[model samples]
Target chain A: MHATALAHSNIALVKYWGKRDRALNLPVAGSLSLTLGGLATTTTVHFRPELESDLVSLDGRELRPGSVAHRRIADFLDLVRNDAGITSFAEVETANNFPTAAGLASSASGFAALALAATHAAGQQLTDAQLSVLARRGSGSAARSIFGGFAEMSAGTRADGRDAHARALAGPEHWDLRCVVAVTTQGEKDVSSTEGMTRTQETSPLFEPWARTVDADIAQARHAVETRDFALLGRVAERSCLGMHASAMAADPGVIYWNPTTIEVIHRVRRARRDGLQIFFTIDAGPHVKVFCPARELSALRSVLSQIDGVNDLIVARPGQGAHLLES
Target chain B: MHATALAHSNIALVKYWGKRDRALNLPVAGSLSLTLGGLATTTTVHFRPELESDLVSLDGRELRPGSVAHRRIADFLDLVRNDAGITSFAEVETANNFPTAAGLASSASGFAALALAATHAAGQQLTDAQLSVLARRGSGSAARSIFGGFAEMSAGTRADGRDAHARALAGPEHWDLRCVVAVTTQGEKDVSSTEGMTRTQETSPLFEPWARTVDADIAQARHAVETRDFALLGRVAERSCLGMHASAMAADPGVIYWNPTTIEVIHRVRRARRDGLQIFFTIDAGPHVKVFCPARELSALRSVLSQIDGVNDLIVARPGQGAHLLES
Candidate 1:
């Protein structure tokens, strides 16, 4: 059996930082995000009874069996195999529209798409929430990619994590906001999100406070999303973004994701805000910065950002659709 | 009466951040620091009944009456006058040997020297502990600059901060550590230390946690200083620096003091340490970074830092003497 699916990358307004559970990939706090239309991942999975092991390919190149990428995908696939009650191995091919492992949340979209495709190929019927739960096993952020537009992943209290999954706050048509991404570098980040989060939780003195304070941020963001309050949303979003980075930075052998270009964009955006432009910036676990503003201010944001040095590429995105099977 | 005093800037190993009493300029926690020999401030105070008001000059430029610099000095002079029970206005001239307001702790030296000279010029003889309390009224960090070598400023319990004063941890000759400063920019930081600390205390969620955690860092740094343990000292010093900056960075609108070159130096220094060089770096709320190592590693530290693109200048400093009267 073979099937294909697609999912979009998400930008967290209220970020999910430290995880409560490592093995289950459960978040320590609720997170709010918007799916981006421009950046995406497409995946196809085929289960063959004759295959001795799972074969994984990314961007048209076959992943070697012993490589990290190959092993992670293989391990994720085992969950689908166990659920389907089959010994058969699968050949999985995942393609990202944007750069991989550059802090673009490729794993979010990759695993979400993979969940949909792998489940379909296994001939198993699962609801959206069920798919979200399954996707979370692959990556903590993956659960949010199961829903379009505004989504919130609950930091579930259950030991099994069956109750913790993403829910849609509003669809794409509910808001007309824009995300202008300034990609600063193409190189892979020195530390992965999993590695960074683990360190922050283990060593950062501020991690407990960070975890405690995030719920208020998530609540504020939720209210802003419900009322379409851009200013309120922007304030909470920037605060949340900086708070996460701050906690990570306090860890011993601290995780510093922002490069010089990342900081340049932040300063310029704040300066522009002082000049009366209604915009805010957020950075995930990489050097790139995403500037959030209303649709009408796109040109102004573009003009200001383009003037900055060493910005590799700019991608303008709007709220996009959720993960679904694509007929081939 | 007239007197001249010289004071050297002290860099905190365990930083002093957040204030419990803004009016008294009392720190939320005690801090540990190392006094530097190369950077200093010299001040001469002449009390003249002929002058209508305090005349303040920094370096060669005369400060306007209502100007921030002028008012701060004048207001501080008021404290000395009140203590000495005299109304005579003073002609105050302070000269910084290094860059002013570029995050080099000029205020620490300036205020400490002013406490000594202004008190001496007013014919008030006091102990060093009493001088520290007076210096703290000018600037919180100035309290620590009153003592030489490694000093610890206690976060005193008294509301008036009369009991809160710096005491010498060890004399200058106790440690032979070298601090190689990389001056990244000569420009003044956008947010002053006082303003940034206030913002962090008022708005940052992590501020409370940061304040709570600093005492342990101080204790560790103090222990390291006592035993001359470089590795332990380095660990806590870097953590304290980043933790303080992190708390500031999490504030609403965030008080980010780092420039592009600041981050570059940090990354390069961390990378070089992987090559087996025993060194650590710390930053005050400005663009410059100080690389700390043994005296023998000064050349190696210089060579590495000089190769950085935007490092403007490098100053090698050892432990320095405390504030003392300069014969004129």
Candidate 2:
């Protein structure tokens, strides 16, 4: 019997936008993210020799039997099997603790967790980097979600994307960084990351400057993390989020990701900047803003952010653990 | 007798966005532009001994004696008089055939014409380089506009900015390029180039990539003009415009110069790409699209572009001649 297995994917403060080498899923800039324990995905893998083809079901709903994600898993299985000289058909059942394909990199973290479970189900063990490369084939950001604490997805140099992998920069104890996920809109994300990135690459003039900042932020962030410099962390985080949004304005039929209330919340936080408040915000493909505040100021920041008109719910998240499995 | 002075200013396709060293007005990127005959400014300078102070007028309206533009002229007079060993205040009068301060780089042509007339009035024989450097103090883009045809404003390495001067790459008649200017909106620009470029230099993510694109476009545009290759000209011009817009997107309150009509015109032109039509569009600080079409396709493109809604007016322009004073 196969028991259910789950994992968490974190949101990046430094965004992953363009591909340096698309074939290897290598990004143009290195990205940093914080993993959260509260938000995660549970995946179960079942392998049977009797099954004719691979199938994937998410949250009790079977997806188009062989979609892009499904093919990715099948391909991974084929590779691992070939290396191990074993042949088999497998079924992957994955469900999110959050939402699937909902603009959150749930798929990134979801597929990454699935990769772990499926590979384990085949009785094969691999290093984290090796696992990340396998997961990146599913989604570029997923590879970064495999590690906890402060993580950096090195933009690989090789044309094949072999050097591209996520590495842990600092552990959770280094800084008391706290994130509050304010769920603004839970509806289908209007823009897909795939289309959004492509539009940004083709149209946004800000993309290059955004890339340069990532490098600068990486160095500054590392020092900030090492020295526990909350001010530096807040500044870098705020600037990175602002840089990503700037690219949004240059997209064809340009639209900002912020809802009316999301903007209001950001403003309130900005207003609090004068008080040396450590509150900063970053958003991905969705309208929600992941407000990063020091745990010491969590109560104060939460009170103000919660009062924002459109914020649906606020969840306080601390540092999360790396990938793991459930024992049967 | 009123002297008729018709002077045209060139527009840099690779814009002179930011001043790297502000005191020197040193730009970060070299820019290229075309002077147009249909759109220009005409000015006449006359010294009046009756007025205790210098008086300036535009069209038929008398401006404040202490106006900033008047002050600039006074300052220029101080420099010239000190350099030439002469002292006298002169009255300056100017008028434009096009809209003033409507984000059209009016000063580019305006100041160029004014500089030429003022020089003649002062009885100072000046070289084109001296005239260009003088015009630049009035407006950076104006320096380039002083020359006709393909021109570039070099971002000088010297601190004094003496090295920064516009040079003609080719005269207007070097290539039979047809331009179609589609007016999308007529109003004061929300962001001035000074404020906008400062923001871009400080915060734009696309700045570095934009700088690289400038270099590439300058080289390619010069080649296209020399070779009279319409395809290459269209390609480089469009890329340069897009690159310029990219910086705008990265601003804190990111906004491009495009209105809805501007978008429509660009899309229609792109859709027509499959028709083997040689066409490209460039926009500056206004919501207008300057389409670079081959001479043979000008009427056809104008006909198609005119059909788009919200377009206020469409004007056809040809390669322009250098600045000259028209005697009456």
Candidate 3:
């Protein structure tokens, strides 16, 4: 049975940037993400006895035999075989509904889709927690990608890392929150998380302060989401982002990702906030900005942004679902 | 008089990336900076009614009649006039040892020196606290420049921000910690702290997490300094930088400033750490990386770093002192 598996990348209200354990892929703290409807990856897996190696393709591009992505898949298979007694060469094909490498947590979605598809292909049933652990081995945020809607990956106080897994905080329909992504560029990241987090951990003096500070936001954000306090959610998310960047500056060579246009849209939003316009914003990875506002404010926010200099394109999105089997 | 007045730019560890109180020039968070040893503007202030207008020169260059620095000086004069019950602009000539507009906090140090000089020129007997408040109005981190050694500006809870001010954490002798600065590029910042912090505040979702996380590090860092635990201090500082960058990723147009070479040095540090090397790194607003190894390990760390791919220049700095008037 080769059922297509589809998974959505959750946009973190409280984002994850660094790691506590790079090997285990454990995070420094808990984070909350909204599963977005517009951004997702779908994959299909099938095992063939005739094939000697596992095959992976993304968006119709056949991966090179020893590419990082393919290696990741093969290595993951090795782990699963050693740990879960799965011994099969699987051919896997994956596709993204949204733009790849656009700072949209494609790896989170990609790995989650692969994990679900491959596990199902093996004819073995696994719990969501088990699936999450498997996904985390690939990317720390991928653990959270196994679930949909409002989810939290608890930074449990254990080296075993079993404590760090995703749990649904609220369903997709809990609140009518809208996210408008201002997509700037889609290029390969200069520093991959595997390496970036390691450098930050070793070099950044500001890292410890940032690690301990976000817990309150995590609690507050969850509470805000539960109560449908959209304003609180937006405000807290923005605060969390600032705190994270403060640590970045404290790193040995302080880093900033904002271009001139990024600055303009931010001010436009701030001006809106000052003028009592209802919307809040957050950013992740690339130069793109994601604004969390009510659906009603979309037109006004867009109008304001359109008038501003340097803002490129805005993709409107709402809460999305988790990894699922799609009938071909 | 102006003989005792010293000006220093307030540099943010938490950095005032943005300005919430634009008119007051209040930063989002308190920053820490070292008052340079060589360059300081010393002026003996005496209110003279005979002068038609205030005379101002920066490093032998006379300021035009209506420049911003001139306007700022004028504004400072007016403020001191109202606060200290004094009037009349005194002639001010300031010289900076460092290059102007080189992203070296020259304006901060310059204005701080100018404030000190002006206040002394005005014959105002202001306390360090009062002077800090005055300095903060000029530039957020300048308030901390009033004191030497490790400084911390209280991120006060007061809404009026009257309680927010800089305090000395320790004297230079607290730790033998050495900071080796590698200057990557000498240029003007594309975005100032006022613009950067504001963008972070308004746009980055990761900012809040960063804000929440640093408190623990602040406490630990202070304690580490008190205890003189170099390893702990380095660890705390490194983490702080990571948290800051995490928020940058959450910004609308996210960024990681490390070029391939920068990344290589960081990776080298991590590799060394994994191999049981004891060197720490931290970064600020620039592309350069600062290593915080002890003076004992300085030679070894530097030699190892020299072999790395993208390092340009390395300047070693010890604990610097507060701004002082240099003898002509």
Candidate 4:
């Protein structure tokens, strides 16, 4: 049996930083995100009862069996097999519309699509909520990618993390905004988000204080989304993004992700806002910057970002749908 | 009465960010700093009975009446006048060996020299600790410049700040270390350090957590200094510096002081460490960076910093003497 699924990438308005439970991938706090239209991944999973081990590939290249990426996918597929009660291996293939380069974190879409495809391929009939929980085991942010438009990851306090899952806050049609992603640098991360978050929580003195502000930020973002308060959303989103980065930077030895271009883009975004662009920028765990603005201001913001010297590329994105089965 | 004093600038190893009591200029935590040799302020205070108001000038440019700089000096003189019980106005002329350009905060030396000269000129007899208390009224970091070589600003728990003052940790000859000051940019600051620190305390979510780490950093640094453990000192100092700036960056609108070059220097310093140069970088509220190493690495570190594209100037400094009377 074989199944294919597609999922879109999302950027957090209220960011997910450290995790409360690393083994369960339970986020330290609830976060809000808007799914993007252009950047996405499609995954195909096929079960082979006679095969000894799972096989995984990205784009057109096969990942080595014991490689970090290959092991991640195979380990995730084991959960799907366990749920379906199948003594079988699987073949997984994933492709992304965006480049597998720096700045873009494809894990959310990749894992979300994989979760849907693997479960369906394994003869498991799981609901979207169940799929969201399963996807989180592969990647924490993948839970949010299971829903469309604005979504919130609930940082449930349950010891077993049964209550932790993301839910849709509103549909794509609810808010008509654009996010222009500025690919500012090609610097590879020294540590992955999972490793870095652990470092921050353990060593950074500001981690607890930063954690305390997340609930209020998430609350404010929810209100802003309900009322279509772009300014309020922008304010809290920017604050949340910077506060998270500040904590990471405070870690012993520090987890510095931003290159020179990242900082330059930050200044340009602030300057553009001062010149009345009405745009706010948010950065994930990498060097790229995403500028959020009204649909009408998209072209202007793009032009502004394009003029920046080190901004190699600009990808325009809008709110899009959640992970869904691909009819193939 | 007339008196002249010279005070050297100092860079905090464990930085001071926020204040406990804004009115009394009480620090949120104790801090340690190294007095720099070349960068200094020599101030001549001449108390006169006939002058209508205090005359203040910097580098021979006469400061206009009611100007910020003029008012600051006049206000500081008021504290000295109160101590000596004299209302006589003073003519204050101060000159720094280093340029009064961006990145270098002249306030530490300026206020320290002012406190000593102003008090002495006002016919007031005060110990070094007492002068430190009076100097802090003008600037918080000035308190640490009261002593030579290594010094600590004690954050005492008294409401009146009677127990709060700086004390010498060690003499200038105790450690043969050098700091290479890399002035990366000439960009003007959007907010003064005092205003920025206040904003961080009021608005930044990461403030309290950052403040909590200071005591441990201070203790670690004290041990490093006592034992000449360069690595330990560097580790705590860098963490302390980054933590303070991290809190500032988490402010509401965010206090962004680093320009592009500042970030570049940070990367270069980190990279050089990877290449076997054991130098640690620390930044204040502005864009400049200071590289700390043994005296032998001074030339090599200067070469490393000067090779960076936007590094405009490099000032080599060693442990220096405290504020003292001039021969004028």
In DockQ terms, which candidate is top? Answer: 4
**CAPRI class assigned to model 1:** medium
Q: What does candidate 3's lDDT look like per residue over B1-328, in tens digits?
A: 3443555433334333445467776655554433333434454445677777777777788888689788877677777778767666667777665555434566666656656666665666667676767776766766777766677776565666666777788866666656665555432234554455666667665576566655666777777778878777767666666565555544644443443344446556666765766787666555567677776877878777777644766666666566555442
Candidate 1 TM-score on chain B = 0.97
In the range B235-283, model 1's lDDT, one tens digit per residue, is: 8999998999999999987889887778888888888888877789999
Clashing pairs in 1: none
Off by over 4 Å in 4: none
What lDDT is reached at residue A30 by model 1? 87
Query: Regarding DockQ, does 2 or 3 come out ahead?
Result: 2
Evaluated on CA atoms against the true complex, candidate 2 attains a DockQ of: 0.14
- Please write out the lDDT profile of model 2 over residues A1-328, one tens digit for every residue: 2435566778787777777766666788888877776678888877778778877787788767568767776776676567556666777788777755444578766867876887788777879897777777667877876787777788877777777888888766666778888877543245667777777767665666677778887788777777878777777776677667666544543434554445446666766765677687777866677888788999988887878766777877787766678774
lDDT of 4 by residue, B184-213 (tens): 765536777888999999999889888888
Predicted complexes: DockQ each: 0.68, 0.14, 0.11, 0.76
As for TM-score, the candidate ahead, 1 or 3, is 1
Where is the poorest 10-residue window by lDDT in model 3 chain A?
A: A185-194
Q: Tell me what TM-score chain B of candidate 4 gets against the true chain B.
A: 0.98
Error of 1 at B208 (Å): 1.2
